[model samples]
Target: MTPPPGWYPDPHAPHLQRWWDGAAWTEHRRTPEAPTVPVPTPPGGGTGRARTVALVAAGAVLVAAIVTGAAVLGSGDDGGAETRTAPTATASIAPESPGPTPEESASEPSADDPSVVEDQLNGVTFPLVDGWVRPQYVAQDDVVMTTDGTYDCPGDGTVCRHGLVVSRTVTANDETSPEALAKADISDAAEDAYDRDAIGQKPYGGMESHELVKQGPVAVAGRAGYYVRWRVHTAKGPGGYVQSLVFPSSVGTESPVLVRFVFDAGADGPPLADMDRITKGIRPVGDAGTGGGVGSSIGPTG
Candidate 1:
């Protein structure tokens, strides 16, 4: 008679049970319990304790085979020995949980936050005020530094404009001072605008011509520098200002770096004093304790 569809003592290993599907044995196996009573040995054969040990060893081998997902066949010990075959069943192991995302794993401070950002270039560092955004390409290019600001214009709902640009170049002329450079730069810009007919253009509504209102020697990071201020002539409404700070090369032979601050006065934009505040805040990128300004030793030039 065939066995029922249930667990029965393994025909090949007496210490373990194998699942039978009413026919052949399956790959599933489990140890119910260690035999409490000694397993009997064949007549005139080994002792009962020895038989028990052999049964325990067989149970261990069966466990290993199951863990490795291998099929084990057993032979029945009836009048005729019969072979049992089982289909292979693989062991299931759960997958590991995923790791943290890029945003979650990042520990560096956010660049978007309204805080000072350090710009490292030309062996100098400057503090960029809150709400200013730097472009990725600026990191690779040291000669040019640029930042932008956004605000709601009087007629226009919202607008973004260039807030600051610091352009550096190596000049061989050691005789040139910051004051001279500032004058030349402002003069050149005014001349260029006039030649291009950009002046009196309504790109900025009512912005007609540019006039140099101030030119003076200023020190930045305790170094000699000069600043030139320009007033925007507007046909109507409050006008804007353009200011440039030129710092001569710390070393006599190298060229000076010019930082320009352009503020287009919107109905809601910052004042000229606020623009000056930004200019005075310029310091070597890493210098925290020192203030940036013009040296008293330098005098203002018309």
Candidate 2:
């Protein structure tokens, strides 16, 4: 019974208070303080044991403020590292296209392709004469027809034309004779349009000599084709007229087709008989449109 010193509680930390000193306990602990309650003085007549010690000190301060608000809401989730918790939201959505499928609208390119210089992968279609057309960037290929505009390059600032044309699909060599690929493609189609013009600019002032103004065999689109035609002689104005014209494909791997030509040689060019009326209007791509020339009318002489 050696108990008569100061602070008590803490019989091994019961919410603090230690310091006994009458028998042992010392290491001075603290916390546990609220209990003092002895103030009812000013009222000279308030008995009943001072109103039951002020109602037991207001019910021990409302049970120590509800156990200190339940230990501060249970240590607010280990209160310290800036609480976070927030994730649960999603909604992306997208997928619904559908439309083109007749074999992808027959392999795309229609509004433009069937317009002119139609190669449609060598099915053939280059009709359109009476001032040739098509190729206003319609997927432009191998110069593919021109001469509906552009004039200037009398020297070279670019652009000059009295006629133009080009088509492809010769699969480079293995000569399948269209008269030896139109005599080996009329000297590279007279040096690609009068020697230099596809932006390398030399305009007519280039190509100074060419000849063979005729060769043979012709009847394109109805197959059996060949052509040569030349005349070049540039270095100035009114000097042009090249040609090539192979031909084979009426559809698929009959592959051959070449077709080339220029013009410009005075009289505002375009009429070596519209190069046999555009080689008598090449057809075969479903044929039929006779508006601007149509094949089978036959175009001959070289």
Q: Write the per-residue lDDT of candidate 2 for residues 1-302, one digit (tens) a residue.
A: 23334444454445655444344443444455465444555377688888788768765654343222111112356675442211111111001111222122223345544544554445556656668665463233455566677788776766666887777668666777788888977887788678775557777778988877667776676667777788888888878788888867665346677878878877788777777777666677557452323244334332
Kindly give the number of clashing pairs for every candidate: 6, 1
Error of 1 at 142 (Å): 7.5
Clash count, candidate 2: 1
Name model 1 segments beyond 4 Å from true: 1-114, 135-162, 170-175, 188-202, 205-207, 234-239, 250-254, 294-302
Off by over 4 Å in 2: 1-108, 111-116, 119-134, 137-154, 160-202, 223-226, 231-233, 236-241, 244-260, 263-283, 287-302
Show the colliding residue pairs in model 1.
125-285, 126-285, 171-255, 218-294, 219-293, 219-294
Q: Give the TM-score of each candidate.
A: 0.45, 0.25
Tens digits of per-residue lDDT, candidate 1, 1-302, equal 33334444565674665555555764444554443333457678988788879778755654444333233445566656555544233232112111121121121223443244333222234544553444433322322223454434332232334344444543545545788777777745433222222233333444567876777777676677788888665554454666667774332123576666555555443445644555566655346555676444333222
Cα lDDT over the full model 1? 0.49
- RMSD of every candidate to native, in Å, equals 27.8, 38.7
